[model samples]
Target: MTSKFDHTVYTLRRARLASQLGAQGVAIIPTAPEQQRNRDSNFLYRHDSYFYYLTGFTEPNATLIIFADGRTVLFCQPKDVEREIWDGYRLGPESAVQVLGVTNAYSNVLIDTEMPKFLENIPTLWYPFSIHKGLSVQIDNWLTVVQSKVRSGVSAPHRLNDVCSLIDEMRLIKDSHEIELMRTAGRISANAHIRAMQFCSTNIRNKNQIFEYHLDAELLYEFRRCGSEFPAYSSIVASGSNACVLHYRADKASINDGELVLIDAGCEYSSYAGDITRTFPANGRFSRAQRALYDVVLESQYAAVSSTRSGALFTDPHNAALRVLCKGLLDLGILKADKCGSVDDVIANKDYFPFYMHRTSHWLGMDVHDCGAYSEPNSLAQNSAPSPRVLRTGMVLTIEPGLYIRPSADVPVEYHNMGIRIEDDALVGDSACELLTRDVPVDPIEIENLMN
Candidate 1:
């Protein structure tokens, strides 16, 4: 219901994409194919992010075609009374022209017949490459048809370009509508995290055993209760030693009374994603050692957040977080000075890899790990990594700096098997960044108070 973005927004996006093509160019994009989950049922359908961006159409078996002259055509499912009785309603091709602002509309069954006609005599063709299955073969068949018309003076396209590359540039920057949906999603996800925390503490207080799945259920209830469509990804509800595993899924593992529970979860509201991670004690009180390491990770997140403003390089926040994490590790004796030397030496040698394996942040949008090139285009130099992309306003990214201390003889016993991560969604601004997922508290004291 919140997807009330004006239809003109999609029209403008299509026109902008069309202008990137030459006058005779044709672009085709399809929604995600529905998959059969079992013998009788199908997986929950979700439209393709790229297709939804340009068309705002959610139905399956749909394709959108745009020409260089700003004309748009859509192919969709045809009306069927019998099928409609079983499945839900569909906006068939008849009403698509008026409803979707397309220049023409046709049933998907006409694709093979009509596509080749449009392909004839085109100088360039554009479609998503390496993403859609069987699309390349379909294009080849269409080209074969066009080639057969050579004697009739019809020519096939000479140049083929990946349409996704062109659209990626447009999607990298969020429009006003996308920002609003993301803000709402962030709020919903933050509330979900708070609910999970409260549920964990309540269960412990009631002298009941809390399984990881129990907390996961609480997160899902809050997400849907607050109007989120679904979880952005599989919820990571790791407790105790399970927290040391970065991508662990919520399972039946019982959460012990004094163990720290790390929940990395978020919700998707209107196709946009919110990603937040928080770690707190199951008993609603942080142990002295837990608080120490938690403070270090929180400080690193603060450093990363401070470096997320516009005009900063994409890697600046990562670098800032890395510096703080390395210093914290050194001060905490996680990286021994005898073997790892100073913080700079530890960083230069990547001595912290065992504890912090993943990057500090990633672009967040429609997909949890959204689409965007991290490096500046054509900025690669000899014997060096590509230059990082410059941060810009309207760009959304996650600031998640974490420390995972797996049990080891080299580490202090009290700090063993402790994993702490404090994450929030950050929106880049002119002078600074706005933290979107802070509706939930990150401070240890505040977390304990909320749990109590």
Candidate 2:
């Protein structure tokens, strides 16, 4: 399928950076390599998020170069009628430059021959090294050539730095186009979750019912039909006690009639990711115990979402969410009153990790676990020391709070084998936060109403 991209926007972005670097260096970005799924079959290609962010091109074996003197070059696959007949289309070097508004373009076959010349006068070269074996070897060869020429007074920049941070900082703020795409992605992902919820309501009627894997497959089908290229990550379709195993990917077990299912799934549109997790009872009605635990998780998630605003500390939402979860656990008799210290002390002790294992929020964008520093000077870490940065507007993140308890004879029996998680994507606005996945229900009553 043809891509929907504004080449002018990418050209402007490259110009913005090239102008900043100013005549001494160049930034180089290479597309990801195609990997073998097995023998004679290749895994579905997904572009590296960083490369996609800068240039919307998705073809493999491609490289982008942004010269400090304000020039952009794209080196890509040459046209081959035979290969195109089998694999599909190729943007070919010449058309890539003309159509994509690149300053110059070349065939990938010429990269090795051409790279040394480009690097000769350049002081610093910015390229992600050691990511792929072939690329790493290529970088080694390039660096070795530069070093060999150094004795003859040829100087290359002595430092190597990853451009991930620079690009990550740029991506933290979403432009109008990016926000719209993410909103669409979130809507589709929310619909997928709703479909699963509705499916569970009907499927669980038969006591001898379906497996979690079947449900996961259904969700993936929904995502694909809705135009997502791939799921943001592996869909977690945890049923019954399996839900307690955070990051559980095995979806083979049959869902019990009365047990709850925690589904954490999302869709990747273009390169941006939309993540949403919803826990609901398989039987279409939450039991008293299930409702209590679900409420706690939902409340904690809501509290965390409320804390996501401009100028807030990155740790604030986590700390706030932790307090809510701990208090709820205590009130529900799942946690003993004096076995730990004060609420803050109990959270500080990390005793809650047995039930709630991950942090409450993370940056969300091009990658599912999107890149960006969550620290600022004088800002405390969620579970550690102070961070080095603060939250700002246009940043998007997930506010997810969960509780998972394995069935144990010694523990609170009423709460045993229950796993509940409520997650929503949010954008930090000027004065408040916008819930991107708000269409997906979270309240126990709301979920039950929708399921029924």
Best prediction by TM-score: 1
lDDT of 1 by residue, 57-131 (tens): 888999999999999999999988888899878789997787778899999999999999988889999999998
Model 1, position 265, has a per-residue lDDT of 96
lDDT of each: 0.91, 0.82
TM-score of each: 0.97, 0.94
Let me know the TM-score candidate 1 reaches against the reference structure.
0.97
Off by over 4 Å in 1: 1-5, 380-385
Which residue pairs clash in candidate 2?
213-251, 375-388, 375-389, 376-387, 376-388, 376-389, 377-388, 379-387
Q: How many backbone clashes does candidate 2 have?
A: 8
lDDT of 2 by residue, 354-380 (tens): 788888889999888888777752344
